[model samples]
Target: MGYKLSRRQFGQLVLAGTVVSGFSYLTNKALAQTPNLNIVGIGSTSIPTDPTAIPEVKTTESYSTHQSSVTTDIPPVGLELVLRSFTTGSTQVIADNGTPLLEPNEILSGFTSLRDGTLVVAITPLITSRRKATPNRLTFLGASSAKTLIVSGLNENQQLGSLLGTNDGRLIGLVGSKNGVPPITLVDINLKTGAISPLSQITIPKDKRVSNLAECPDGKFYTSLLGFHGETSLVQLGSNQEKPIVLAQLKVDGQEWNNGLQNLVCSGTGQLLAFGAMRYQTPNAVYSIDKKSGNMTRLENFDVTQIALVPG
Candidate 1:
């Protein structure tokens, strides 16, 4: 159920992952000119936003059948509710500028910032963003409170994007076993001192695949390389490291174009925002990376299912 590319078949899988890393792009303004990485456009949720105050809306899906119903079963394209701060009247900002830290039934898979504003939601399950939604492993919550002792450990098929941490709060993600076959990993967790780290082990030897992930700002953890020979890498892990250093790579996809990349934000200084998922209505790309000339740029064309840095 993965191989749905149509932005002209992802521009021919980004021109065959760029002619196997010849490093090119004379289009997206030569990749956003690099640096601050801007390519804005917040919410569309397929269009028909506000939906008049956002109440359940008769159990969901009823903005007049979502504009005109193209239906890819869409329903995780928006929502980052938690106001009283980054005000803009009635904002949405689903990954363009920043907006994420939701914890009511948990959807955000990564984001950190402590103190006055308090937010550390790696709590999973919005249909499957990896982990915490199995035999009900005490799904992190507040009202009917569940993260009581904070023990939900079963990062099944972890594609845990937003690439864990180290900007004062680390919790990197991605770890698989059962369904995501052959070993696909890259983990780290310290959801505020719950400590448990282990980075990089990816063992996909026979038609590869991996998603977007980021953890930069000195302590690197960037990822790319999606299915059947895909590659667009950058991974770094230290502190008595157990191995994880690919420096940079944007070459690896030559076997009938399998398409890759999917949400891996890390902006605000280090600059990196990977989010490319094609197929169906096809429209999601937000590269904008440059960890020091590895170069990549392309933001705002939205379809983004995740990536939040919320702060006007």
Candidate 2:
């Protein structure tokens, strides 16, 4: 027969266990909220301090402007939805399969497709008020009765970086400086009410400015840090960390290490890829970056001007 306990004894035992378990649960919750800011460099590729030191890699793919068929279904495996901006101040959403989604009149700096198929766009102004920065606007397009304004008042000093869609109908974006300044602010945008709230902010180390920022699948943010001395490294930002954590130095041979990097996209494959266009008229290459080690793997060369990835 199983051992039986007295009524009072059983009650006391249950209470003790509950108290212990509750403490353990609260401890884990606190630890989870804290971010580890340790730098983890994996590859032996020495991070170059000189901007002139570019990684040497042969071009494996060519740029093309062909569009594939559009579908209402979720993008297929190995393919993602993309937003391509033109020099004429026009923006169009295209799938990795080459399907055209939408074109708008305003210049879109960042965009994200929500879980409910709603499209949230960041309208980046071409002109900035040098005297004082003004708020950028967020517009809602498609999946609604008509185009609507969602939120405004993004960071004015910093041009808006890539926007990442969240599972809860919210969006995350970076307000990064164009002149290599510090204090890149991470903000949250609501799709329903268009409210904007800053979750956290981190400044880069001296001589380093963020080129592009993307949301990793694990809820952390990452960016490509361009050094004033001509070096570039990938770094991660945690909500609890006050400073950015360096992941790995990027290898950009023959590519402009400065503002040439654009359209940083976090993919479902747990990597970030972007168009590394050194300058106009130069063949651009797509490179994939590992979030953990900051290592970059060149994918293929393509000609699209600016490409945004579909949110995973």
Candidate 3:
């Protein structure tokens, strides 16, 4: 039971100060810097799939609500949907054509993009209200969908980590706990149906967590790690050997990237694109990490809060 924001309502939200924090300003700055880059927004006006779908609006009190919202810039048509998450717990699905749309819920966790151009979003419900606790639900959204699908099975205890779309067309999720107990890791989800198949947990090094996941052209996948000291590393996943192999190390401002890694996406080639800022007010950069050598090349810099690859 959400309402689509008209252009006037959008302005009111911005001027009246009801708009989420950090989102409107950052998104506008990002678009201004990348005038040629395409962006789009995606979200639902109604929760058609969740039977327990209740209309709950919790913005000021929600820790996960994304402070950022995208600009209304128009992009070329026929591009894939790119999803962006904000620290405020909001998630947005923008079209390659550069139109931004909003979802009612703040996706405190991360999201993933599929090869087919669909998006998988893990909705973070409001913490204070049981009527709005939307933890375990996943949303499948695309351009040509007859309707959006929202499926629930995720638990609050399952701290949802990286969401990756595998080459085999299966979507994989890394489930871990902050306290580090119940070592059950890795869940393979049925995209069509919100079914979960639990897999054996692999040992991730202590003091480090997965920052980003990206797949290569050869069908292998890569992951970026964030250490306790705010450093980042590239690693290869899924081989005959169970352990992950460290590939490259990345740094920002001549130091270990301490600002934090927000999202990682494949650049449509074999390389991986890492997006994050070292610290607040620091210019954000998109780094291209060579899959073979683990070398990171700075591609561009702007105020971009989130980024993704749209199908050409």
Candidate 4:
């Protein structure tokens, strides 16, 4: 069954995941510390220099007027690209020589970098109507002006999930199951034609849905599964494997990660980085996952929805 949220909850939360690479544009200080290794994400807070630092609570402002104010659904905000350094704990926006890559009335659903460092992002137009259907467009961003691509071959109800850039330089994405079924499928995204080709279906439990996708150096793919009742799991699968192997039930400080995790990316050093999206009673943060043990170490208090790694 599909999970539904209220309008207020929809405004407060965003589905997170993105494929990221290329850090040649960061500051010299960040480069000197981590070299080619950097992290980019969509969030409200910057990466903390101290891992133990708690995120400060943010209060909402209130406005009062004499006339009657109409209430409406809060539209999703366009998330900005924030560059982060894991080693140095520094953060900045990804810009073209100090010029920001900001777009109006667009929500970033997913993104990945081409081999030449071109960023391909999946954008959904900002809309307030819950009944209106909005298709996602693929956009290329770099030194030049932004170019939009029309993505074809998806049904009216299908939506793209997290994006992944293969080691062989191929762009891959996850497509939710059609007919509201289980086992999401992997698809190859043709950058030139903006067409999607189905590869294989990921075998998971009936009540579970994939949140993000990542590929490691060993050629194996990893993903996080969100259960019906706040259950989360990390699984590894490959072409030769008959079925996905459960690595661990995701946990932090001996407590279950019920809020779930997304934006899974393999770091330059083969480490897995993920963004834990915020939910009621759960804090949004970044964490490093141990593939062998399924243990998680919180890296910072940033409220990131999606994240990617820049290779040196």
- Quantify all predictions' global Cα lDDT against the true fold: 0.38, 0.44, 0.48, 0.56
Candidate order by decreasing TM-score: 4, 3, 2, 1
Cα lDDT for residue 194, candidate 4: 81
Query: Please, what are the lDDT tens digits per residue for candidate 4 over residues 38-153?
Result: 55444332233356644333321112122222233222222334434444555554322222222322345676655555556776533334444356678675444457677788
Off by over 4 Å in 1: 1-26, 29-152, 155-185, 188-235, 238-262, 265-287, 293-299, 307-312
Q: Give the Cα error of residue 162 in candidate 4, in Å.
A: 0.6
State every prediction's TM-score relative to the real structure.
0.27, 0.53, 0.60, 0.68
Worst lDDT run of 10 residues, candidate 3, spans 15-24
Predicted structure 3: lDDT: 0.48
Better lDDT candidate (2, 3): 3
Q: What is the lDDT of candidate 4?
A: 0.56
lDDT of 2: 0.44
Which candidate gets the maximum lDDT versus the true structure? 4
Question: Which should have the higher TM-score, number 1 or number 2?
Answer: 2
Tens-place lDDT per residue, model 1, 95-130, is: 222232222223334433221112233443333333
How many Å off is the CA of 261 in candidate 3? 1.5
Backbone clashes in model 2, listed as residue pairs: 51-230, 54-252, 54-253, 55-252, 55-253, 63-303, 68-98
